[model samples]
Target: MANARNLSTSSEPLNPKTFLSSIFDAAVAAADAKLTIRGHLPQKPKGRTVVVGAGKGAAQMAVAFEKAWDGPIDGLVITRYGYSAPTERIEIVESAHPVPDEAGLMGSRRLLEKVAGLTDDDLVVALICGGGSALLPSPAPGISLADEIAVNQALLASGAPIAAMNTIRKHISTIKGGRLAAVAWPAKVVSLVVSDIPGDNLALVASGPTVPDTGSRADALAAIAAYGMKFPDAVMAHINSRAATAPDPADEKFARNEVYLIASASVSLEAAAADSRRQGIEAVILSDALEGEAREVGSVHAAIAREVATRNRPFTKPVLILSGGETTVTLRAKGKGGRNSEFLLAFAIGIDGLNGINALAADTDGIDGSESNAGAFCDGSTVARMRAVGVDAKAMLAGNNAWTAFKAVGDLFVTGPTGTNVNDLRAILVR
Candidate 1:
């Protein structure tokens, strides 16, 4: 249990902003590849050691493995553009994220080719994390990169949960949902996963590239229907065609594969909570697997914070409320912001300038949605400050323009690529 006070050795007194930032830093530190990856590393294989992975943290995980392992390793991994870390042995390739691209498709093909004809003695180390589903795109035989992109876009805008999105992704791909692991049949596969999804479902994280998939084509269709998504014809045909089925979990080929959760949102939240307690604040972790719309979740959290502040019904004052999970944002308005920003905006609205309440919400990956900022911060004065500047907070919230609102208030959190992904971390400090 690392103390929050040790996060910064400076002599300055820790204020609300500094304390919140320290809490977030503790969360990110807990999920850092260099800190967590070495502990989960498998023994050096007797035969050829191949490293294949994809995600925002894939490259960093590779670097960590390279530093910890003494054996010679070679392979390739695809990561989001700008999220790539320097690695000497394992090749790193940059590709588009949140949407699949030709680069990702080509990389997935190359990875499959690399694993072909592997003997039972060989080892395949897969570095998996969030954003891998899009970073390692391998469209089905009938689907094109453009078709995959369209379906991803629709799914993202539909506010569908990550599990639902991954179910559909597995059904229309060549390498997802245990298909990657299937290609390396008979070879020992040890996947080191940094989970970003709520519940840490091994099958859902990054679409479970190296684990057994229990979902079926019917599940994909049900998700599409439930979300009212209008996917492209090619995507629909691929799912409806005979090639829709994923690799069966009962297959003996998967008997040698192992999936290890190196880090997760729950661990990160616990780290934050420990630090808050060290700072003499009563920390209450509402939930680490919270899901639903970002705004609604923020509103509910705000209500809880208010109750603690006004009546102390649930807890005493000077309490820090913490949570971790992935929240969705339905694109109702054409605005530039991610779920974290939207959550902060709604929280600000719900608090309504009530004194003695301050909060911070940010994605652990240091990128909130598609925005440049990780997320945003809001205090009791956030609403008042925006109103003083002639900015209507409610109007901005309605337009889904939380980015603009936070930017105007100079509250946008901008920590460039934390080199890790564990989902989102949020904290509300009520005094």
Candidate 2:
């Protein structure tokens, strides 16, 4: 964790919105790949040094690597369409995210070609971040791109855990599950990753494009059946026919590969906690790896906040309860909202009419689920404000219309794009 610093505040009372926002900001600033990659650079190689990357932060990671290294770097990186950064030697290719597209397929093919014929004297630096799976959707030999897209759609709505989803993604993918590292076989590979997966499992992040994978096609099928995910014949055909083809742990190809955890949710949460401490507020970090239904998680947080407020059993008043991790939301209704909105809205309802409680939840990527807003803010009066605006908080949540509910109350938090992804950061302040 970084050093803690006090937040500048006037003599007046605490501003919940501003306080929560500052905490969130500190968390995001800690995960910046451009800053984090400086301490983890590899030595200059004898032959050519190629950089291959993918995810929302891939473009920025490439730019940072280009600036730090003292050699000629030429390679391509795929990122979400709007999440590109300026780079001199490295080429950036914008593609789709949360779902694969034609552009991702073409860029994936090009990336494989760039690292295919590397020599033992060369170096391959893999810049991987959260959204690499959808950004590098190069399907296996017999599977079509359409098949991959179909599976992606199911996985997004399946309400399954991220590990299960990435396992399925890796099995059907040609560029994931250490296949990328295998392609650069004899050449040394170093991966600098901004992890979104809980527990900082590099093998599951972006489906382990440059790391060994222990998951198999059988695991994917089990997840599909467990989640009741339905896909078309083509997708099912690839899933059923494919065996466990991902690179094994003892593969000689990955013997020289190196992986670094550049940034992660746990580190970000601790950073936020430290900031809160320096700001004259007690901070309690519940967990950095909490994962479950979004609304349910919100409700649980509300319960904890209520306990702290009513009794102060675990913590005293004026404390900030923090948690970080990627949460899932099942598509219950055809309403417009994301996981963060659902979380905050559920929290609003649970803490309705209760005073001295406020909270904020947001995805580090600046986008929550498929919605435009990064997240929404909720205080004790949030539900009252929604009721005054003719929005039933519970109904809105059930309909997956938390975005609209929060919009009516003017609490939506939009941060455009942070160019980094470490999953979600949530805070509850009780004063």
Q: Please list the Cα RMSD from the true structure of every candidate, rounded to 1 decimal place.
A: 2.3, 2.1
* Whole-model alpha-carbon lDDT for candidate 2: 0.88
Report the lDDT of model 2 for residue 430. Answer: 91
Write the residue-wise lDDT of candidate 1 on 98-175 in tens digits: 888889989999999989899998999999999999998888888888888998899899999999999999998889
Whole-model lDDT values for every prediction: 0.89, 0.88
Candidate 1 residues lying further than 4 Å off, grouped into runs, are 1-14
Give me the displacement of residue 144 in model 2, in angstroms: 2.2
Q: In model 2, how large is the Cα lDDT of residue 134? A: 91
Count backbone overlaps in model 1. Answer: 0
Residue 51 displacement (Å), model 1: 0.5
- The best candidate in terms of lDDT: 1
* Clash counts for all predictions: 0, 0
Model 2, 281-353: lDDT tens per residue? 8898999888999999999999999999999968888799999888888888888888889999999988998
Model 1 / residue 165 / CA error / Å:
0.4
